[model samples]
Target: MTVRPLNSVFIGGRQIGANCLRVLVDMDAPPQLVIPDPDDVGVDSWFESLVKVAKELSLPTLRGARVKDESAIKKIRALKPDIIFCIGSMQLIPKEVLAIPPLGVVNIHPALLPKYRGRYSTAHAIFNGEKETGATLHFMDERIDSGPIIMQEAFPIGNEDTARVVYDKFTEVGTALFKRFVESLKRGEEIASTPQDESKATYYPKGLPSGGKMDPSWDEVTKKRFVLAMTFPPFPMPDID
Candidate 1:
């Protein structure tokens, strides 16, 4: 079996990021260089701790998380990876770095593109009473979650489901797409990607809607989904008036 001659690099932290790295290694693609979540390195982050163990167990990794920082950008540019897979990156990757890779950057988002685009995607889905939400794997560009679609899979949302449940389901589907996407490239299969329609696009900002506010007049179903989506114990409830 002939594998594609592609040198991939990973820029992400935590679940989706870690999962992508695992796929890269399992496929025997190459000895990848991982730039862990910047906040994880010096903090008490389990994500960082797991990365450290991977390195100690001999997983080739480099430390980087901020794409906007000059020094970190410089280090990444020097590596010249063919493709950069980003997941769970807090900082938006600048165009300067995006142009450095041969295949460019691709990110996995929890919501289907051109519909729910932004940080609180899953929550927005629940709050707005969306019946169906899915995952999207797309090529990254200058805009936020406004990238061409590489692969997408949709899953139904239970009327009584919470945000984490939506997240867990999407993560399962998205990770599978990630695996198939990489393998398709290795096998030289054509990836049919399509441009997103901006007219149908809707953008939601990070954090709470109406700037940390919620409507008390909403029905029980709406309120239930909102609370479930936004509030998890050990984490404080969202500030509402």
Candidate 2:
């Protein structure tokens, strides 16, 4: 069946990247940027970059507390559109925020969940030596990256792949999958969602910059594993301390 397009909210930092831009164009939706104020933790260029992407797409941008801003909530309510397309929205969207656009508050996550859940999924996957890794499109909940899964696709991890490369690949795959999900929703089709196994769900905190840096003082095997786990470009491993 042919799927209809939608009007969506693009919430994320790193909107300038190719993966995200392509998804924005394909959705063919009017977007709004939702970013945290500068005072918020984890607020940075990524958020600003996303707003820029929205502007390029001729979408509105909103910067305020995700939960406390009455104006922002009202603005979203007024839009009353089909779906919310959220990418790197670093903050945990509150339950109040989720209720605003319940049906359409969807997110593109960077890792296969029930496994790696956090801001650093790509790095975690590489460190774990998982044979396959991919992305997921799911409903946003009060919890972080822990909603019912709408869709996921996995790709083999190459021996030479780095955290940066994995991130790039996942973002590309995720955006495409999300576009399809939006289309399905617009057509009144039920997008499939799978409940993740809680026991299998593993959470990893943001690691040191050199996540897999080997200590010159460590054993050979430990060093090798570190080398393999942290070999990705653009993301340097911290020096062994």
Candidate 3:
């Protein structure tokens, strides 16, 4: 059967977002509109530019726009996208925009949902001494990362893995999930999703307060994990008290 192309919109930023967007484009499933995080949100040296890649692909790009804003909602509504993909965007997509897409807004999260449900997943997972961490793809709801899960796969976390290492693993698994998702859509298959278990859900707020400072009373092992978890290259490790 010939598959019908999906009318899609993409809201993303960062290296992972750039990579996932390329997957869509390379598969001939590029979105109708690309909404990248504004310069202020994604301009850091650590991240690749989603906007630049969108432009290079000749995709219609929108920047400096928040999905919660009415103006932005109007633009998205006008497109009447069949599906909206939100990958690597830190903002929680509002319900108004979520209601716009018939197939629902899909999100690719760096950590397994219902466990690490926020921005600092890898760091928190590493600091908590988790033996494994993984990525998830889900249909977004009004709440943050508390959506119906489409897919999840876990990878073991090595004893010496830092936040950056776990994050690179997340990127690998997350982008692979994106590839599978797009391929399914290309084949015109109806994706199945399971609602997340609310009881298992946990959230981590953005940023590490006190600069991820280790508590002086923490055990040496705990302190060591904290240091590793907070370590991401191009940024120095948190100062030990």
Candidate 4:
């Protein structure tokens, strides 16, 4: 059987990098090369995990990279991949890199997007007391997650669900949805996607306030919501003086 070609994958960020890598390998839809980001916490570890898997299949270690800024783009251009899959990595692809891929670039964001187009989507969902959240696979544009949606997999945000739990579920559903999407492509199926509603779109800047004063005077429901949102570990419980 002829394996489908997926070109190169630019992976980093938290679980997005590892989960995408895992699914690609599992579905045999892995790219010709992988651009790893060691700067991201545990990203290199994800690469190492895949390295072992690659060796077992008699494949070379996926390309390892640590450079940043223009130098990194130059190196990527030199590699000449036909498609670029962005899993994470804060670096944005310029027009020069986008031109190299006929398929353009595809990325997966951990929110129902068109809603959460920027950073801290998971935490935002918890903070806002959302009852539903999801992950989106879409084309990459100069704007954030404002691209056309290739697919989206949604999961319930239980009243008790923590941000960490929601994040994990996003990866779980995202990987499964991504596999189906890629398989359809390999079978010569045309992709059908609807443009995101710009009117409903929202963007979150990085370092959005994760913690604030936790007032004991607040109602029980509001206090619980605050705890749910801030308990994700990175945002410490507000210091009570």
Candidate 5:
């Protein structure tokens, strides 16, 4: 008997998003609809474009539709997907959108949830001198990165590793985790997840730190770590004086 692929709507952007989408296609379980980040165009030159990847694969795409918006929600609801996979986009998935998919909205976050629960997890991890950081696949709730985690895998952060390096590591580990999740669905295994410990949670606000300025008051080691955390090519390094 032939098994039917899961019906899914993909909401993603950036390199990791594109990579995850490719993984789905490779596994013969591509999403029914693709929603690339609205602001992704011309946002950055360094990362792969989800829009481009979707178009290249001839997958149906809806660009410029924010999930929080009623119109986008309606469009997604019409598809009647079993699940919604959201990755890489920083926009918060509202409860309205979250309720559309029966199985829940799955999100791939770059850091271990309840720890680095914000936009700049990799950078924050490096800046804080964390020896290891990891990726998380979780269900999306109203709060940012606060949902129960489906899967997580940690990897070491080297002393010489910068934010860019760690980010690549996240992409690798996170994408693999997502692929595993898809494979599980193919095998008809029930999803398993665990609620995060709120006491261990941490959050960082959106946008660059101190407007991307290096604090002169920081000691040599701190300054160095800060700079390392902020380093990514095709984007200017943090200003140091």
Candidate 6:
């Protein structure tokens, strides 16, 4: 359904991209709210950064539990928002929670849909030596990252770039793309969501921590791949062998 000047609630963490920020910035549009609580993980810079962004954008945000919390839901529903934007939210939203906002919810995935549809898309992308990767704005479904896609745009992965660089790069691109979508929504425009081609879609499970260590006796190409593959900071690489 086409919506106009929606009251949007931002369900996101520290790693939220620019697109989510834009939605927060629209002139008195949907009052933006943030849920910064982290679940099963230590403090993350992404959450801290999100708070800063909200302040800078002058967007209204409320912080509460990371996952399904009745209190948070009650507050959000009280606002009677039109739509919800989930950005790098660490927890899976419950179906009941998803139903609260009538206009539906949209999530920003770091990887292109149908492929890299789960956690660690960046690592998988680099491990596979993908030359290009982009962001996917899709409907949030019962399955993880398996929703119908609303919009997607690819950015070239530099040969010298590591997963961390790629992650940071996509934030800029993804956020911009997200802003465009918010504008369209405000104008009551409907975006077409292309169902993913399941045949070609691939999902990668969480990689073993030890598996990321650089292999000894590896050739130059393999060594470089090792570096790129384990570029994300949390997944560290072994010292150059």
Which ranges in model 3 have alpha carbons more than 4 Å from their true place? 40-44, 207-211
Worst 10 residues of 5 by lDDT: 37-46
> What's the TM-score of every candidate structure?
0.89, 0.80, 0.94, 0.81, 0.94, 0.84
Write the residue-wise lDDT of candidate 5 on 65-172 in tens digits: 788888888999899999999988867788888998888999988888889998788898888889999999999998889999999999999998989999999999
lDDT of 1 by residue, 1-241 (tens): 7678768767776566666666777787743566666666634342434365446547666664467778867877787887888876666889988898878798988898889999878878887888898999999999999989998999988877777778778878888999999998888766678999999998887865434466789777766777767753345777655
lDDT of each: 0.76, 0.64, 0.87, 0.69, 0.87, 0.72
Best by lDDT: 5
Please give the lDDT score at residue 30 for candidate 5.
86
For TM-score, candidate 5 versus 6, the one ahead is 5
Better of 2 and 4 by TM-score: 4
lDDT of 2 by residue, 19-79 (tens): 4545656656445444433243432332235544445566555744563467766776777
Query: Deviation in angstroms for 82 in model 1?
Result: 1.1
TM-score, candidate number 1: 0.89
Q: Ten consecutive residues with minimal summed lDDT in candidate 4?
A: 40-49
Pick by lDDT: 3 or 6, better one: 3
* Runs of candidate 2 exceeding 4 Å displacement: 1-5, 15-18, 21-24, 32-48, 63-68, 208-221, 228-236
> Which candidate order results from sorting by lDDT in descending order?
5, 3, 1, 6, 4, 2
Kindly list the per-residue Cα lDDT of model 6 for residues 1-241, writing each as its tens digit: 5456667777776465334665556634645465544441334343345655666676676654754777787887787777888886667888877887776788888898888977778767876778989988888877888888898999998888887888887787778778877778777876678777888788776662236676677778777866786777765556765
Model 6 lDDT-worst window of ten: 39-48
Better of 4 and 6 by TM-score: 6
Give lDDT for model 6. 0.72
